[model samples]
Target: MGNRILIVDDEWNMRNLIKIYLSREAFQLNEAKDGYEAIEMADQYAFDLVVLDVMLPDIDGWEVCSTIRKTSEIPILMLTARDDVKDRVLGLNIGADDYLIKPFAPEELVARVKALLRRRKKDNREIDKLLITFNDLSIDYDSRETWVKGTRVELTPKEFDILYTVAHNPKTVFTRDILLDKIWYSEEFRDLRAVDTHVKNLREKVRKAGLSFNPVKTVWGVGYKFNRPEDQY
Candidate 1:
Protein backbone atom coordinates (compact mmCIF):
# COMPACT_ATOMS: atom_id res chain seq x y z
CA MET A 1 0.00 0.00 0.00
CA GLY A 2 1.08 3.58 -0.65
CA ASN A 3 1.92 6.03 2.13
CA ARG A 4 -1.01 7.22 4.21
CA ILE A 5 -1.43 11.04 4.31
CA LEU A 6 -3.85 13.09 6.34
CA ILE A 7 -5.15 16.32 4.77
CA VAL A 8 -6.46 18.82 7.34
CA ASP A 9 -8.33 21.82 6.05
CA ASP A 10 -11.60 23.54 6.90
CA GLU A 11 -12.50 24.15 3.31
CA TRP A 12 -14.16 21.40 1.33
CA ASN A 13 -12.70 22.80 -1.87
CA MET A 14 -9.19 22.85 -0.44
CA ARG A 15 -9.38 19.30 0.85
CA ASN A 16 -10.74 18.08 -2.46
CA LEU A 17 -8.04 19.94 -4.34
CA ILE A 18 -5.25 18.42 -2.26
CA LYS A 19 -6.78 14.98 -2.59
CA ILE A 20 -7.05 15.38 -6.34
CA TYR A 21 -3.39 16.23 -6.74
CA LEU A 22 -2.13 13.68 -4.21
CA SER A 23 -4.30 10.94 -5.69
CA ARG A 24 -2.18 11.04 -8.81
CA GLU A 25 0.79 9.98 -6.70
CA ALA A 26 -1.13 6.94 -5.44
CA PHE A 27 -1.00 8.00 -1.79
CA GLN A 28 -3.63 6.74 0.63
CA LEU A 29 -5.40 9.88 1.85
CA ASN A 30 -7.51 10.88 4.87
CA GLU A 31 -9.18 14.15 5.74
CA ALA A 32 -10.07 16.22 8.82
CA LYS A 33 -11.99 19.49 8.69
CA ASP A 34 -10.72 21.03 11.93
CA GLY A 35 -7.87 20.90 14.45
CA TYR A 36 -9.64 18.65 16.95
CA GLU A 37 -10.41 16.10 14.31
CA ALA A 38 -6.87 16.24 13.05
CA ILE A 39 -5.42 15.59 16.49
CA GLU A 40 -7.83 12.76 17.17
CA MET A 41 -7.17 11.16 13.82
CA ALA A 42 -3.43 11.53 14.28
CA ASP A 43 -3.63 9.75 17.62
CA GLN A 44 -5.86 7.01 16.29
CA TYR A 45 -4.03 6.33 13.04
CA ALA A 46 -0.55 6.00 11.66
CA PHE A 47 0.04 8.51 8.91
CA ASP A 48 3.17 9.14 6.87
CA LEU A 49 2.56 12.84 6.24
CA VAL A 50 0.19 15.64 7.13
CA VAL A 51 -0.91 18.50 4.87
CA LEU A 52 -2.19 20.98 7.44
CA ASP A 53 -3.89 24.32 6.91
CA VAL A 54 -2.90 27.03 9.39
CA MET A 55 -6.34 28.48 9.84
CA LEU A 56 -9.11 26.28 11.18
CA PRO A 57 -12.46 26.69 12.87
CA ASP A 58 -11.26 25.20 16.15
CA ILE A 59 -7.73 24.87 17.56
CA ASP A 60 -5.76 26.25 14.57
CA GLY A 61 -2.86 24.57 12.84
CA TRP A 62 -0.03 25.73 15.11
CA GLU A 63 -1.68 24.28 18.18
CA VAL A 64 -2.45 21.06 16.35
CA CYS A 65 1.13 20.84 15.10
CA SER A 66 2.48 21.44 18.62
CA THR A 67 0.17 18.79 20.03
CA ILE A 68 1.23 16.25 17.42
CA ARG A 69 4.90 17.00 18.07
CA LYS A 70 4.32 15.94 21.65
CA THR A 71 3.70 12.39 20.47
CA SER A 72 4.79 11.89 16.84
CA GLU A 73 7.42 13.06 14.36
CA ILE A 74 5.34 12.80 11.23
CA PRO A 75 6.24 15.37 8.57
CA ILE A 76 3.89 18.35 8.46
CA LEU A 77 3.45 20.71 5.50
CA MET A 78 1.80 23.90 6.70
CA LEU A 79 -0.49 25.80 4.38
CA THR A 80 -1.14 29.47 5.12
CA ALA A 81 -2.58 32.44 3.32
CA ARG A 82 0.03 34.73 4.82
CA ASP A 83 3.37 34.80 3.05
CA ASP A 84 5.19 36.71 5.75
CA VAL A 85 8.60 35.47 6.72
CA LYS A 86 7.55 35.66 10.34
CA ASP A 87 4.71 33.26 9.69
CA ARG A 88 6.98 30.85 7.90
CA VAL A 89 9.53 31.01 10.69
CA LEU A 90 6.81 30.54 13.26
CA GLY A 91 5.62 27.42 11.50
CA LEU A 92 9.09 25.95 11.35
CA ASN A 93 9.79 26.84 14.97
CA ILE A 94 6.53 25.23 16.09
CA GLY A 95 7.53 21.89 14.48
CA ALA A 96 6.02 22.23 11.05
CA ASP A 97 8.48 20.60 8.64
CA ASP A 98 7.59 22.58 5.53
CA TYR A 99 5.62 25.72 4.72
CA LEU A 100 3.57 26.75 1.70
CA ILE A 101 1.78 30.02 1.24
CA LYS A 102 -1.78 29.98 0.01
CA PRO A 103 -2.53 30.48 -3.70
CA PHE A 104 0.56 28.38 -4.36
CA ALA A 105 0.96 26.50 -7.57
CA PRO A 106 -0.38 22.96 -7.58
CA GLU A 107 2.94 21.65 -8.77
CA GLU A 108 4.79 23.37 -5.90
CA LEU A 109 2.46 21.82 -3.38
CA VAL A 110 3.00 18.40 -4.88
CA ALA A 111 6.74 18.92 -4.95
CA ARG A 112 6.93 19.98 -1.30
CA VAL A 113 4.80 17.04 -0.21
CA LYS A 114 6.99 14.63 -2.15
CA ALA A 115 10.11 16.24 -0.77
CA LEU A 116 8.99 15.95 2.86
CA LEU A 117 7.98 12.34 2.30
CA ARG A 118 11.32 11.59 0.71
CA ARG A 119 13.13 13.13 3.67
CA ARG A 120 11.09 10.98 6.04
CA LYS A 121 11.99 7.83 4.12
CA LYS A 122 15.65 8.77 4.00
CA ASP A 123 15.68 9.36 7.76
CA ASN A 124 14.21 5.91 8.32
CA ARG A 125 16.77 4.32 6.02
CA GLU A 126 19.72 6.07 7.64
CA ILE A 127 18.90 5.27 11.27
CA ASP A 128 21.62 3.32 13.04
CA LYS A 129 20.82 -0.38 13.23
CA LEU A 130 22.38 -0.93 16.65
CA LEU A 131 21.38 0.70 19.91
CA ILE A 132 23.82 3.55 20.66
CA THR A 133 25.15 3.79 24.21
CA PHE A 134 27.70 6.25 25.62
CA ASN A 135 28.31 6.75 29.29
CA ASP A 136 24.85 6.66 30.87
CA LEU A 137 23.09 7.76 27.70
CA SER A 138 21.30 5.15 25.62
CA ILE A 139 19.47 5.74 22.38
CA ASP A 140 17.34 3.14 20.64
CA TYR A 141 16.81 4.14 17.03
CA ASP A 142 14.23 1.51 16.22
CA SER A 143 12.17 2.34 19.27
CA ARG A 144 12.90 6.09 18.99
CA GLU A 145 13.56 6.24 22.68
CA THR A 146 16.33 7.68 24.80
CA TRP A 147 17.39 6.71 28.28
CA VAL A 148 19.69 8.27 30.85
CA LYS A 149 20.84 6.01 33.65
CA GLY A 150 17.91 3.64 33.07
CA THR A 151 15.39 6.48 33.16
CA ARG A 152 13.63 7.24 29.90
CA VAL A 153 14.09 10.85 28.81
CA GLU A 154 11.28 12.57 26.97
CA LEU A 155 12.69 14.19 23.85
CA THR A 156 10.93 15.95 21.06
CA PRO A 157 11.22 14.39 17.63
CA LYS A 158 13.81 16.90 16.44
CA GLU A 159 15.86 16.50 19.59
CA PHE A 160 15.88 12.72 19.18
CA ASP A 161 16.95 12.98 15.52
CA ILE A 162 19.76 15.41 16.33
CA LEU A 163 21.01 13.24 19.16
CA TYR A 164 20.85 10.07 17.12
CA THR A 165 22.50 11.58 14.03
CA VAL A 166 25.50 12.89 15.92
CA ALA A 167 25.79 9.96 18.32
CA HIS A 168 25.63 7.44 15.48
CA ASN A 169 28.59 9.12 13.83
CA PRO A 170 30.76 9.38 16.86
CA LYS A 171 33.53 12.01 16.74
CA THR A 172 32.41 13.34 13.37
CA VAL A 173 31.67 17.06 13.13
CA PHE A 174 28.34 18.05 11.58
CA THR A 175 28.04 21.68 10.57
CA ARG A 176 24.81 23.54 11.20
CA ASP A 177 24.01 23.57 7.49
CA ILE A 178 24.55 19.84 7.24
CA LEU A 179 22.28 19.14 10.20
CA LEU A 180 19.63 21.45 8.76
CA ASP A 181 19.69 19.51 5.51
CA LYS A 182 19.70 16.17 7.27
CA ILE A 183 16.92 16.99 9.70
CA TRP A 184 14.77 19.83 8.34
CA TYR A 185 15.46 18.92 4.69
CA SER A 186 15.02 22.48 3.50
CA GLU A 187 17.39 25.37 2.75
CA GLU A 188 14.73 28.05 2.88
CA PHE A 189 14.96 28.42 6.62
CA ARG A 190 18.55 29.59 7.01
CA ASP A 191 18.58 30.14 10.74
CA LEU A 192 21.46 27.98 11.93
CA ARG A 193 20.58 29.01 15.47
CA ALA A 194 17.71 26.52 15.37
CA VAL A 195 20.19 23.66 15.48
CA ASP A 196 21.97 25.23 18.42
CA THR A 197 18.72 25.65 20.28
CA HIS A 198 17.80 22.00 19.88
CA VAL A 199 21.26 20.80 20.91
CA LYS A 200 21.18 22.97 24.03
CA ASN A 201 17.74 21.68 24.96
CA LEU A 202 18.88 18.11 24.36
CA ARG A 203 21.90 18.52 26.59
CA GLU A 204 19.81 20.06 29.38
CA LYS A 205 17.26 17.27 29.17
CA VAL A 206 19.90 14.56 29.32
CA ARG A 207 21.53 16.28 32.26
CA LYS A 208 18.24 16.70 34.09
CA ALA A 209 17.59 13.00 33.54
CA GLY A 210 20.71 12.18 35.63
CA LEU A 211 23.24 11.57 32.86
CA SER A 212 26.72 12.28 34.14
CA PHE A 213 28.39 13.22 30.87
CA ASN A 214 27.56 15.41 27.92
CA PRO A 215 27.59 13.32 24.76
CA VAL A 216 27.12 16.18 22.32
CA LYS A 217 30.22 18.35 22.30
CA THR A 218 30.52 21.58 20.36
CA VAL A 219 33.79 22.27 18.54
CA TRP A 220 33.69 26.08 19.13
CA GLY A 221 34.73 27.30 15.70
CA VAL A 222 33.09 24.31 14.00
CA GLY A 223 29.84 22.41 14.60
CA TYR A 224 29.05 19.52 16.96
CA LYS A 225 30.13 15.92 17.46
CA PHE A 226 29.54 13.03 19.80
CA ASN A 227 32.35 12.76 22.29
CA ARG A 228 32.92 10.10 24.88
CA PRO A 229 33.56 11.18 28.46
CA GLU A 230 37.26 10.31 28.22
CA ASP A 231 37.61 12.38 25.05
CA GLN A 232 36.14 15.62 26.45
CA TYR A 233 38.42 18.14 28.16
Candidate 2:
Protein backbone atom coordinates (compact mmCIF):
# COMPACT_ATOMS: atom_id res chain seq x y z
CA MET A 1 0.00 0.00 0.00
CA GLY A 2 1.09 3.57 -0.66
CA ASN A 3 1.57 6.18 2.06
CA ARG A 4 -1.56 7.07 4.00
CA ILE A 5 -2.55 10.76 3.81
CA LEU A 6 -5.43 12.46 5.60
CA ILE A 7 -6.93 15.52 3.90
CA VAL A 8 -8.75 17.84 6.33
CA ASP A 9 -10.99 20.54 4.88
CA ASP A 10 -14.61 21.58 5.16
CA GLU A 11 -15.30 22.36 1.53
CA TRP A 12 -16.28 19.35 -0.53
CA ASN A 13 -14.80 20.78 -3.72
CA MET A 14 -11.46 21.50 -2.08
CA ARG A 15 -11.31 18.04 -0.57
CA ASN A 16 -12.27 16.47 -3.89
CA LEU A 17 -9.70 18.52 -5.75
CA ILE A 18 -6.95 17.42 -3.36
CA LYS A 19 -8.06 13.80 -3.55
CA ILE A 20 -8.05 13.88 -7.33
CA TYR A 21 -4.59 15.40 -7.47
CA LEU A 22 -3.05 13.19 -4.76
CA SER A 23 -4.71 9.94 -5.86
CA ARG A 24 -2.62 10.10 -9.03
CA GLU A 25 0.48 9.64 -6.88
CA ALA A 26 -0.82 6.31 -5.51
CA PHE A 27 -1.21 7.71 -1.97
CA GLN A 28 -3.93 6.08 0.09
CA LEU A 29 -6.14 9.05 0.91
CA ASN A 30 -8.63 9.76 3.71
CA GLU A 31 -10.85 12.77 4.37
CA ALA A 32 -12.10 14.72 7.42
CA LYS A 33 -14.45 17.65 7.07
CA ASP A 34 -13.74 19.35 10.37
CA GLY A 35 -11.16 19.66 13.11
CA TYR A 36 -12.85 17.13 15.37
CA GLU A 37 -13.04 14.50 12.67
CA ALA A 38 -9.51 15.25 11.62
CA ILE A 39 -8.24 14.88 15.17
CA GLU A 40 -10.16 11.64 15.64
CA MET A 41 -8.93 10.12 12.39
CA ALA A 42 -5.40 11.22 13.16
CA ASP A 43 -5.58 9.56 16.56
CA GLN A 44 -7.15 6.35 15.24
CA TYR A 45 -5.15 5.77 12.06
CA ALA A 46 -1.47 5.79 11.28
CA PHE A 47 -1.22 8.40 8.55
CA ASP A 48 2.03 9.31 6.87
CA LEU A 49 0.94 12.92 6.25
CA VAL A 50 -1.87 15.39 6.86
CA VAL A 51 -3.01 18.07 4.39
CA LEU A 52 -4.71 20.48 6.76
CA ASP A 53 -6.79 23.59 6.06
CA VAL A 54 -6.66 26.38 8.63
CA MET A 55 -10.35 27.32 8.45
CA LEU A 56 -12.33 24.51 10.03
CA PRO A 57 -15.72 24.17 11.73
CA ASP A 58 -14.18 23.44 15.10
CA ILE A 59 -10.86 23.89 16.93
CA ASP A 60 -8.99 25.19 13.80
CA GLY A 61 -5.90 23.76 12.13
CA TRP A 62 -3.43 25.32 14.54
CA GLU A 63 -5.02 23.47 17.43
CA VAL A 64 -5.19 20.29 15.39
CA CYS A 65 -1.54 20.57 14.49
CA SER A 66 -0.55 21.17 18.11
CA THR A 67 -2.70 18.31 19.28
CA ILE A 68 -1.14 15.94 16.79
CA ARG A 69 2.35 17.16 17.58
CA LYS A 70 1.79 16.28 21.23
CA THR A 71 1.62 12.63 20.20
CA SER A 72 3.06 11.99 16.72
CA GLU A 73 5.75 13.50 14.56
CA ILE A 74 3.59 13.20 11.44
CA PRO A 75 4.32 15.71 8.69
CA ILE A 76 1.62 18.39 8.24
CA LEU A 77 1.06 20.50 5.13
CA MET A 78 -1.12 23.48 6.07
CA LEU A 79 -3.45 25.28 3.64
CA THR A 80 -4.59 28.80 4.32
CA ALA A 81 -6.26 31.51 2.27
CA ARG A 82 -4.54 34.26 4.21
CA ASP A 83 -0.97 34.73 3.04
CA ASP A 84 -0.04 36.97 5.97
CA VAL A 85 3.44 36.18 7.24
CA LYS A 86 2.11 36.09 10.79
CA ASP A 87 -0.40 33.40 9.86
CA ARG A 88 2.22 31.34 8.13
CA VAL A 89 4.60 31.80 11.01
CA LEU A 90 1.89 30.81 13.44
CA GLY A 91 1.28 27.56 11.62
CA LEU A 92 4.97 26.75 11.36
CA ASN A 93 5.54 27.74 14.98
CA ILE A 94 2.71 25.47 16.10
CA GLY A 95 4.30 22.39 14.44
CA ALA A 96 2.96 22.32 10.89
CA ASP A 97 5.85 21.15 8.74
CA ASP A 98 5.01 23.26 5.68
CA TYR A 99 2.51 25.87 4.52
CA LEU A 100 0.75 26.43 1.19
CA ILE A 101 -1.51 29.32 0.28
CA LYS A 102 -4.91 28.59 -1.16
CA PRO A 103 -5.32 28.42 -4.94
CA PHE A 104 -1.86 26.91 -5.17
CA ALA A 105 -0.96 24.90 -8.22
CA PRO A 106 -1.74 21.21 -8.02
CA GLU A 107 1.84 20.55 -9.04
CA GLU A 108 3.20 22.73 -6.22
CA LEU A 109 1.13 20.92 -3.65
CA VAL A 110 2.36 17.61 -4.95
CA ALA A 111 5.95 18.83 -4.92
CA ARG A 112 5.77 20.07 -1.31
CA VAL A 113 4.10 16.86 -0.20
CA LYS A 114 6.75 14.78 -1.88
CA ALA A 115 9.50 16.93 -0.40
CA LEU A 116 8.13 16.58 3.13
CA LEU A 117 7.73 12.82 2.74
CA ARG A 118 11.25 12.54 1.34
CA ARG A 119 12.59 14.47 4.30
CA ARG A 120 10.69 12.23 6.68
CA LYS A 121 12.09 9.17 4.95
CA LYS A 122 15.61 10.54 5.26
CA ASP A 123 15.04 11.31 8.98
CA ASN A 124 13.78 7.76 9.53
CA ARG A 125 17.09 6.43 8.22
CA GLU A 126 18.78 7.82 11.34
CA ILE A 127 16.67 5.71 13.72
CA ASP A 128 19.47 3.24 14.31
CA LYS A 129 21.63 5.90 15.98
CA LEU A 130 19.03 6.31 18.66
CA LEU A 131 20.90 7.69 21.62
CA ILE A 132 23.96 9.95 21.92
CA THR A 133 25.56 11.07 25.15
CA PHE A 134 27.90 13.96 25.88
CA ASN A 135 28.80 13.94 29.54
CA ASP A 136 25.60 14.97 31.38
CA LEU A 137 23.63 15.68 28.20
CA SER A 138 21.91 12.88 26.30
CA ILE A 139 19.56 12.83 23.32
CA ASP A 140 17.28 9.99 22.32
CA TYR A 141 16.47 10.31 18.64
CA ASP A 142 13.78 7.66 18.55
CA SER A 143 11.80 9.11 21.42
CA ARG A 144 12.61 12.73 20.53
CA GLU A 145 13.52 13.25 24.16
CA THR A 146 16.51 14.90 25.81
CA TRP A 147 18.03 14.18 29.19
CA VAL A 148 20.38 16.18 31.38
CA LYS A 149 22.06 14.54 34.32
CA GLY A 150 19.69 11.57 33.86
CA THR A 151 16.61 13.81 34.21
CA ARG A 152 14.44 14.30 31.15
CA VAL A 153 14.23 17.95 30.16
CA GLU A 154 11.17 19.07 28.21
CA LEU A 155 11.89 20.67 24.85
CA THR A 156 9.60 22.00 22.19
CA PRO A 157 9.81 20.23 18.83
CA LYS A 158 11.89 22.95 17.22
CA GLU A 159 14.05 23.25 20.34
CA PHE A 160 14.77 19.54 20.24
CA ASP A 161 15.59 19.65 16.51
CA ILE A 162 17.98 22.57 16.91
CA LEU A 163 19.72 20.91 19.84
CA TYR A 164 20.01 17.58 18.05
CA THR A 165 21.36 19.13 14.85
CA VAL A 166 24.07 21.04 16.70
CA ALA A 167 24.86 18.25 19.15
CA HIS A 168 25.22 15.73 16.33
CA ASN A 169 27.83 17.96 14.71
CA PRO A 170 29.94 19.07 17.64
CA LYS A 171 32.34 21.95 16.99
CA THR A 172 30.61 22.72 13.69
CA VAL A 173 29.49 26.33 13.60
CA PHE A 174 25.91 26.66 12.32
CA THR A 175 24.82 30.06 11.16
CA ARG A 176 21.21 31.07 11.83
CA ASP A 177 20.35 30.69 8.16
CA ILE A 178 21.66 27.12 8.00
CA LEU A 179 19.71 26.16 11.09
CA LEU A 180 16.54 27.75 9.68
CA ASP A 181 16.78 25.83 6.44
CA LYS A 182 17.59 22.55 8.19
CA ILE A 183 15.02 22.79 10.97
CA TRP A 184 12.19 24.73 9.32
CA TYR A 185 12.53 22.87 6.00
CA SER A 186 10.97 25.86 4.22
CA GLU A 187 12.41 29.18 3.06
CA GLU A 188 9.21 31.12 3.68
CA PHE A 189 10.21 32.35 7.12
CA ARG A 190 13.81 33.61 7.49
CA ASP A 191 13.73 35.53 10.77
CA LEU A 192 17.23 34.82 12.15
CA ARG A 193 16.21 35.83 15.66
CA ALA A 194 13.96 32.78 15.77
CA VAL A 195 17.05 30.63 15.99
CA ASP A 196 18.46 32.66 18.85
CA THR A 197 15.15 32.53 20.68
CA HIS A 198 14.93 28.76 20.41
CA VAL A 199 18.52 28.25 21.43
CA LYS A 200 17.99 30.48 24.44
CA ASN A 201 14.93 28.55 25.48
CA LEU A 202 16.69 25.22 24.95
CA ARG A 203 19.64 26.37 27.00
CA GLU A 204 17.45 27.53 29.85
CA LYS A 205 15.47 24.30 29.87
CA VAL A 206 18.55 22.09 30.13
CA ARG A 207 20.21 24.41 32.59
CA LYS A 208 17.20 24.39 34.87
CA ALA A 209 17.31 20.59 34.66
CA GLY A 210 20.73 20.53 36.38
CA LEU A 211 23.18 20.59 33.48
CA SER A 212 26.53 22.14 34.44
CA PHE A 213 28.07 23.02 31.06
CA ASN A 214 26.56 25.03 28.25
CA PRO A 215 25.32 22.61 25.60
CA VAL A 216 24.99 25.19 22.80
CA LYS A 217 27.78 27.68 22.47
CA THR A 218 27.52 31.01 20.73
CA VAL A 219 30.16 32.22 18.25
CA TRP A 220 30.76 35.95 18.29
CA GLY A 221 29.40 37.51 15.06
CA VAL A 222 29.02 34.05 13.54
CA GLY A 223 26.35 31.64 14.82
CA TYR A 224 26.29 28.75 17.28
CA LYS A 225 27.94 25.38 17.83
CA PHE A 226 27.67 22.46 20.23
CA ASN A 227 30.05 22.96 23.16
CA ARG A 228 31.20 19.37 23.43
CA PRO A 229 34.60 19.82 24.96
CA GLU A 230 37.14 16.96 25.13
CA ASP A 231 36.02 16.30 28.68
CA GLN A 232 32.48 15.46 27.52
CA TYR A 233 33.57 12.20 25.99
Which digits, one per residue and each the tens of the lDDT, describe model 1 over residues 34-140? 99999999999999999999999999999999999999999999999987899889889999999998898889998999999999998876664458888788899
- Model 2, 84-154: lDDT tens digits are 99999999998999999999999999999999999998877666367778888899977999998889999
User: Which residue pairs collide, candidate 2?
Assistant: none
* Model 1: pairs clashing at backbone N, Cα or C within 3 Å: none
The candidate 2 region of ten consecutive residues with least summed lDDT is 123-132
TM-score of each: 0.58, 0.57
Q: Candidate 1: worst 10 consecutive residues by lDDT?
A: 124-133
Q: Which stretches of candidate 2 lie over 4 Å from their true place?
A: 131-233
